[model samples]
Target: MSNTPSPTPLAPRRTVVAIAAILALGALAAVLILRSGTPGGSGAEAAHGHGHSEAAGHADGEHHGAAASAHAHDEAHADGEHHEGGGAPAARKSEAGHDEDEGLIAMDAQRMETAGIRLAEAGPATVRSVLQLPGEIRFNEDRTAHVVPRVAGVAESVAANLGQNVKKGQLLAVLSSAAVSEQRSELLAAQKRLSLARTTYAREKQLWEEKVSAEQDYLQARQALGEAEIAVSNAQQKLAATGASAGGAGGLNRFELRAPFDGVVVEKHLAVGEAVQDTTQVFTISDLRSVWAEMRVAAPDLPAVRVGEKATVRATAFDSSATGEVAYVGALIGQDTRTAPARITLPNPDGVWRPGLFVNVELTASSRQAALAVATSAIQRMEGQQAVVFVPVQGGFRARPVRVGRSDAKATEVLEGLQPGQPYVAEGSFVLKAELGKASAEHTH
Candidate 1:
């Protein structure tokens, strides 16, 4: 009021400047508030108006800053939680994929793809009645021979060796014997006497007929000739029995041993320069063209085999076979084996059927009609009293009990529980059986 001389212009300028500065500070604070993410409200302006309120404004700004900081922290925590939650699904999916891969690996390791199975149909089949018998090939006794010395002698030379084929009357050995020489000498002496007696008898007969001499002299000559003839006949008969020739080196000691039959020399006991006895078997000869197969037939199977029955014989050593007919059936059973002896006459043209060869014999017992039959492998043992077979079904096999009739080593005749043309498992039936076994075992466990 006193001397303040019209300060209007400068006051206006000062007011303007103060207002501009305040406006500028307000603009900067607005920018800072925007950067700080502070909420705009009318309560903030009232808080900044007075000096006492300035303190409250600052306190309010601090409170807003602390709330903004807390909100930002909460957002960061939420983002981290979201990221962790998003990763959980991918991790779970990865673990699930690994599990699936493991499952595939496990499945591939078992090698269950190579198994095979077969099925068959039940139908009418011609089942042969097969009789199995243990047999042995033997030499035909009638066609074989044992060469024995007829007289005691020393063996000079043996012409036949073991397993040598010989014909009838072929020389087998040569023997030297004193007894043969003595018999030959006696024969020669008898023959000489007989020749002289024959001449004298002829002269006596002529004299008697012409009446050129006395009756007593002629009768004495005839009687002497008759006695000499009788002695000669006896000596000749003795030499002939000893297998000696009539005129070969009179009184010779050499004897020729001949084969009695046409056969192979299976055994040779005499050698060159070996002593032989009258009872010694010098050679054994067997006819290999025909052999005998001796088969042991059980008592139960005896009726099926008879004389003249056909049989087949097989041996392990030879691939060839022998066909024959039953030669004889023993009336008595063997004491040890409880079997009857059946002999078959086998044709051994190739000499393959040797004696003492172990063989398997198949005898045709009897033939009958069968409506249905199957391989023996199709039938499996089931319970204690019976058996069964698996018939094919929709998804599996149906176990069917069957009544079996006559069964050979190859096939079995179906008596019941099967029909013609019904499909069944013929091979690889053990798989189904094992499945059922496993099921039963699991149940029991």
Candidate 2:
């Protein structure tokens, strides 16, 4: 304060005012530089052309402070206009991208045909409600038989083999048995006595008529002949019971087992020299022209599975199926399984079905008319959607999400998201689904 003269209040005020003015000028120049260097400067310049012209006219008359203020206002207005123009095109682009992402799969007519895409109109259809039950293929009991020898004997010869086809009355095996031999011997002895008895009766009748002998003596001869005849008849019946012929060229004990019907020998338990019992099952024969598809029906499904209803039998181990009628349904349920046994009679003329082969039985529980339906094959599963159907749009096909109801092998009922008369891809729709998936992956990348 001693070395320099005291500054005046007016000088300080003037200095502060000059500094403020310089700062305002510097700020305005910086704003102009920034706007000119940016990419949007051209569009900003055109939009603010009128402001620039008016500013030019006032530049000479306005003070530095006012000019800086006006330039700042113009810079802000230009920036606002630039931002608006930039956002408009961006908004339009975003709208287009959204439309493209709405499950649209672009395809040309030629490409669609090449991919085997076929279309069908959705309309009223009958939807069959099918009840599926587990089952197993079994022998047709009505045409199957278990063969046994009536008398216990050692197997002399076994002519039939496992899996051999035979005709009715075909000799299966020959056995030699003491039991049969005894019965046959009795018949032969009785027959010889019967022959003698007939001669005696003829002589006795002649004597009685001619009075060559006493009446009591002739009566005794006649009684003896009658007793002989009775013994022969009883002996013949005994031989018949043992399945032995009264007079045959073979040994007296030779017993032959014959097939009761035309069938295939599915089982054989006897072999040459093997001793067997009367009750032992020796052979199992079955006529495989028909087979049984047997299943266990639960209490709830018993009503739907009735005699004479049509059912479809499908093999579980292989691709085979047949349609048949429900032949039998048990009147009582099993105490352990709490289910009733049901059977379907399938004509197996080709002999494709075999016993013990597991299968599935499909029965039509009911049927109803659906207002709108599509082929079950037409339905496809997509991410975030339960099911979708491909329908034609302007540029290509669009995947329309659908709510499905009852479904069978042929048709599926549509509960929503479809209309009658609307055309949709029925066959080869899987091709379209694959295409859609590929498009989504590409877009994601």
Candidate 3:
């Protein structure tokens, strides 16, 4: 009765097994349908999904790469604009590359004119190597003389004052000396005695010719005349040695100191009414028409400094220069200065070159002709290796290296790195050089 009523008790149902079999059949049917769809069915679906994911990833990568490439191209273009090819700068690029590492001065035509950046042409010229030696103008010793009274005397008057120009035989000073008076007296007395002896000899010779007097008397008279003549000559010689004339009717003590040559009275030791001795030098006269340029030559320049070598002497006090020749070169070296003495005669007709004046002896150490030359002020230091000169460019100037050959105070010889007739900055190159240095420093930082 329970079995029938509870009824088949769900027939002891395998409900879990039936549900599992149905799910399995549904999955199998889905698998078969998927297999019938594409060639690989489920595999193809999985592949399709994987391909979609890969495509999305690839698209993202492409976008990012394109953006990066565009950015790189823009950067390259900007760089190209800055420099010619990111290498050596262009010649005209100096305007912008003024802050570059190159030694270039950038300026436009108007800028150049405003900045006073001048340019000139280089041409062939002679360069003179000048050796500047210190020297001094010395008095012409050869034409200088010290005038002194030969005898002790009292200075009566001074005719010529110091610094007075006098000619030869011009009286510088006058003096009165007792010694000169005595000498003149002796000469006069001797002259009178000589006249008496001459008269006596004439008388005795006339008598002897007539045989009225003895020959002994005539001989004695002749001997007396000869003795008188000798005495007169001796007296006259003494007066001459004392620089006094013998036949002065007035004061015999009067004496004068005369100039021996054309000169200026440089020194006067005696004044009016002053006593002077024989050894006292009353006047010093010097000829200022010519002066000596005394120079100290070093040992290295001894070979070049010779007698009669051409030289130029310049006055340091003023703007004056005179060309002359070397007059002397000493053989002995100075003990203290370690230099040799040299000299050059300079004409000072205008009296401008005075003694003790400082001078510069521009000795021509070397001289040569050059193909191209520039002003010494135009040379500028560049990179500490070579000399640079600013030459004219289209818009401005450029610094070019040049090899120096010879130089002087005014000009310099360019041996290389320069051509004749090439314009360059002649007077104001230093300004350009300063600008170039500033630009270089900025570029470095």
Candidate 4:
């Protein structure tokens, strides 16, 4: 009490309150210590619970950031997929001459039409394997002739002109021949002698019958008549050989050159006042109703170019053509050029197939049925092979790899990789090939 400041009755009450307050604080501290000692209510458990909540929030934030980054990266990649807005594929060079477009090409109808690209459907067709042979037009030798004068003569007049048509036995030219004149003179003399002999023989016969002459005299007169008759017959034959008949006796030396057959005068060597010999060919006439197309085939193709095979003859000068069968084929190859000769007899009803005109002969080697076919001009080279065809797609075309079989000038056969009635590019497919090449080149860079 002496050391402490509280000694009155109010001090005792304050001391009591202080001691009560100290006891209550200590009791609360003890209760807290007990709770900390228990396993279920430990202070570390509380701290660990708070740490778990913070870690969970941090993990969620990191996951959201990673998802955003992944989405952005994928968006930068392939943009060309056949979906909304028609996204395209990634650009990449292909070793097979194809781009990453998967053999697809896009174009509008107007643009395709302007590029001269025509579309058609592939269908069943006949593929004719034709062999093209070099050839020329020639005269039909079977109906041609070379006219030669039978007797030596001087041309008096030319009745037929070059390129003039003439009928059989028509006069082509007239000639005055000395040999003919001599023959005619001999014939006239023989006729005169025959007349005199006939008169003598008649008188002798009358004398013999009436006892006016001896039997020997009558026989001699008869023999003379026979001799004169023989001489006249010989003279007539000699004059008849020169294509001349004794018509009017005024000009007996006249020789007429007549056309051996109906033909056109293709050549004329003799003119007015021109000297011609018996062996000289003075005129040439050819029947142009038909002509021959002589084709020169290689030795290897000789077998295919046989007689009776169908052939097409096309003129090089004009847009003219004709169909005929091969008439003749040479058995032996030419010694100089090593080519076998074949011929086609073409009917020239209009006389249009002139001689010396160049021509081409198409011989059908074989024919076959095609499952799918298109125009030959539509074939394009792709991946170093000429077996590519452009097929129609939505708003575009595709380069389809195909197996090609036989081919001809007009059409090609598709062995595989195509279907009948599928539309494809029939003409101007080269433009698509060019565009594909450009695309490939750009991809390479």
Best by lDDT: 2
Alpha carbon deviation, residue 202, candidate 2 (Å): 3.4
Which tens-of-lDDT digit does each residue in 1-445 have in candidate 2?
3788776656455445444444444455455556466664564454355444444444444445555775676677578668976898999999998887667888898998899999999998999999999999999999999998989899999999999999999999998888888888887888888899889888988988998878887888888888889999999898777666787558877889999899999999999999988788999999999999999999999999999999999999999999999999999999999999999999999899999999999999999999999999999999876799999998889989999999999999999999999999999899999998998898789
Q: Which stretches of candidate 3 lie over 4 Å from their true place?
A: 1-128, 368-372, 375-377, 380-386, 395-399, 425-445
Worst 10 residues of 3 by lDDT: 11-20
Off by over 4 Å in 1: 1-128, 214-230, 249-251, 334-339, 374-404, 408-412, 415-445
Model 3 TM-score, 2 decimals: 0.68
Cα lDDT tens digits for candidate 4, 1-445: 3676865565454444444333333333344444455654455455445434433443433434433443443343323222422422322223333533555677898989899999999998899989998789998899899899889989999999999999999988889888888888898899999999999999999999999789999999999999999999998988778777765344877888899999899998988999988999999999999989997888888878887988999998999999999999888888999987788999998998999999989998888988788899989988777579998887688888888889998899988878888889998899999888877788679
On residues 1-445, what C-alpha lDDT tens digit does candidate 1 reach at each position?
5876764554454444444334433443444444456784543463335323333433433444433443564566557668877998999999997654331212121222333556678877667788878888899987888888788899888899998889999988888888788877887787788788778878877887899877777788788888888888887787677665556552388888888878999998988889988889889999999999887788899888988888888996778677789999999998998988889999888878889999988887766667898778878885475688878664456567899887765678999999999888787656666666665576568
Go through the candidates in order and give the clash count of each.
0, 0, 3, 4
Model 2 misplaced regions, further than 4 Å: 1-91, 94-98, 206-230
Give the best candidate by TM-score: 2
Q: List the candidates' TM-scores in order.
A: 0.59, 0.79, 0.68, 0.62
TM-score of 2: 0.79
Model 1 Cα RMSD, Å? Answer: 18.3
Worst 10 residues of 4 by lDDT: 76-85
Clashes of 1: 0
lDDT of 3 by residue, 1-445 (tens): 4555543544223343333333333343344444356555666456455434433443433434433443564465556546644554555577676444355566777776776766677887778777889999998788889888989999888889888999998878878889988998898899999999999999999999999999999999999999999999999999889878777755888887788899999988888989988999888889998889999998988887889888888888899999888888998999999999999988888998899999988877777887788888899987766798888765556789888988898788898888888888887787888888887788679
RMSD of 4: 16.0
Off by over 4 Å in 4: 1-124, 189-237, 248-250, 377-387, 396-399, 425-445
